[model samples]
Target chain A: MVTVNGEQKNAAGQNLLAFLKTEGYEPERVVVERNLDIVPRDELEKVVLEDEDVVEVLRFVGGG
Target chain B: MEQERKLSKDADPEKDVQEGKSLPDQLQIEDPEEVKKQMQQILSKEELDRAFDARFPKEMQQKFRGARVAIAGLGGLGSNIAVMLARSGIGHLLLVDFDTVDVTNLNRQMYLVPHVGMPKTRAILQILYQVNPYLDYETVQAKVTPENVKELFGGYPIVCEAFDKPDQKAMLVRELLGQCPESTVVSGNGMAGVGDSNGIRTAKFGNRLYVCGDRTTDVGGGVGLTAPRVALCAAHEANKVLQLILQEDS
Candidate 1:
């Protein structure tokens, strides 16, 4: 199970970038954190998620 | 003496800047009467120091006194951020803006009716000085771009992004994160359109970027930005600045 934004999802062996696309998050707008460490934008594809990893996905919104 | 009293009473800051001269430029004239009048309008240095100490909390006063923060814009987010920081006793600020106050900005930006023609940087500083006379701040009337981003925000430990455009926000964050990795940046997104104020939140992204707002809302389909919501996000940014300042390691 992988926790994304506080909700658990079954993503035991998915690539971080693939998981983001599968979950409908825009790759450019979203920032990904794996297990409390930030995954830099360029390194998203190289990183893969394992079981019990907590992830947080955030994006920039359009106001001041 | 009577002439001095009349000149002091009749001195109007707005009228003094009639020739497109800035506030500081008007003060540079060597006229003794004008100098005396300007002196009477502002508090003495000793009074300003006393007011700063009395207006802020005694325990956290020193922390605020020593912290230097930069606000990257002077629109809705930047203006309110400056005001809140000033009232909270944050001692130093660096404000940057290339725009002047417009009538349209009155809805959300912190400008009064008479400030329509004034540069946003100058107008906001006027209001801030009234709130806390002892604040140490500098205003740069220029745009922040990738080339000048680091130069504008380089020294401050914390920089607040208040640009109205999404691309500008992204540019500043990217530049700061790369150039000044040790600096913390507080930015806003998705605070447009009236919804639950509770939806606005502060989240830490990467090591030094903290974003405030719901991260979803934008202005379109007749939905507009309002003051209450924008100010809430500004409060979050200001609070984060204060928190970082009070940090022992900061």
Candidate 2:
């Protein structure tokens, strides 16, 4: 079991993209910073999630 | 009083020196009176006038004094943005630049000869301080990276993306929107070496990201950036920042 945004979830050894899709979150609009390194937007699907991995997803808003 | 003066005049030179050294003991003897006298001297009319000038008119300057803005690059657009903000009385500014001033920068950077080889942050800060002594400024002497982007922009309410490199600008835009959701990020495009037709434009993408520059789709084709185009883009960005702080709907 791993924690994401303060909630405990089971990754069950699946890839990160599948888990995010299952969780109903879009990958394009959000950026993932995993373990202090930003996971580039282009490589969101290629990276796999490990057990107990901490992921912070942030979204952009429009402003001046 | 004449007799006492004569006695002091006749006193031994060594004894007079010793007694003069004990003046601090006399101060301790009547410390309360001494403190009252000191306080009275410290708070005189001239001192009060100086203090009032330093701190008065708070209501009139409150708006500009509360704004925190960050400039990503200290090149032509970044330099003009910083100067305009300082002159306009923006209270706090964060300037990030890792490049050193070079002879080539003189063409459009507005930097002087003395600033050559100096870090761009220090040069810009010195000019800003000269412009407005009360302006608050912070300098990041290194390049803005993904690791330190949040730290650099933690408290700033707005960021001006004046970076010259396309990849750096794209990364900054991504990081700012990702980390600082509440921050207003303005990006510039195609302000290089263009004429009047390639000046500046302000476009609102939704309600968060505002882009100001020439949208002529001719970026990085060896067309160098000039003063007029860069200054125009910076003015647009500055106006946008002011409007955001004033809560005027853009």
Candidate 3:
């Protein structure tokens, strides 16, 4: 099981970016943090997700 | 004869002659009136009052007497933010920047010509103290990373993210939210171009993170920033931080 934005789901064995895309999120609009370290925007395709990994995705919205 | 004798008796001629001789050729009594006149000629009380009121407010005049704020960068955004915070009475400031003050910084950064070769943190701290003698400041002459982020933050509640690089700014935001959830972080974006004054906006992401500046819409190819826009973004960030501190729903 992996937690993405507080919801738990089964590990799909896909890369982090693909997982997020399949989950209806846009890559350019958000920042992703896996565990504690920030996964840079360019490295989203290379970073693999594992079981029980907690991922936080933050999106840029209208803000000052 | 009677008038002459009366004048001689009352005058004390010998004593007056002796006193006159004892006095120096040029009497130089230190006259406070002369010094006061010189001072008035130099500066008026209204000017002094304006200078005092410009930096120190009645409520925050001494509020941050022992507080410490660590600024992570000293570029266009960092330099302006640091100086404004120091002037607003943040007591102790810890400035962190590995870059040196460059000529380009002069266009937007408030640092002067003499700070060219000096480290950004040191140069900005010196200028900050010059603006307000009441400020106490320190410097970290390196970049902020995950290794030193905790140590750098040092329990400070507010952090202004002024880094130009997107990755560095995102990294700091990630570190703060994950490691120090209680800390409030303010960030700026799309402030590098020309736009109307109304372009600047402040928005709250959640309870903790607030971002200020023009959104990416204003980041068209040729938009260049001036001091007014940068200062406006920083002011919005600082105002949001103040709101967070006061527990206001911003």
Give DockQ per model, in order. 0.48, 0.03, 0.10
> lDDT value for candidate 3?
0.67
Model 1 regions more than 4 Å off: A1-57, B1-41
Worst 10 residues of 1 chain A by lDDT: A25-34
Compose the digit string of candidate 2's lDDT tens values, residues B37-84.
443443453554355458646543467777888999998778888998
Q: Which ranking of candidates, highest DockQ first? A: 1, 3, 2
What is chain B's TM-score across the candidates, in the order shown? 0.80, 0.73, 0.71
1 against 2, candidate with superior DockQ: 1
Q: Each model's TM-score?
A: 0.72, 0.62, 0.65
In angstroms, the error of model 2 at B75 is: 0.9
Q: Clash pairs of candidate 3?
A: A64-B201, A64-B202, A64-B203, A64-B211, A64-B212, B193-B223, B193-B224, B194-B224
Candidate 1 structure quality by residue, lDDT tens digits, B1-250: 4553345676776676646423454433333344434543565657766776776667688888788999999988999999999887787899999999999899999998867888988788777766766667688999887789778888789999888776567667767776676678898877887899999999888678889988878764357899999999899999999998988464
Best by DockQ: 1
Q: Residue-wise lDDT of candidate 3 within B86-126, one digit each (tens)?
A: 65666677777889988877877777887787788767755
Residue B123 CA error for candidate 1 (Å)? 2.2
Q: Which ten residues in a row have the lowest lDDT in candidate 3 chain B?
A: B20-29
Classify candidate 3 by CAPRI docking class: incorrect
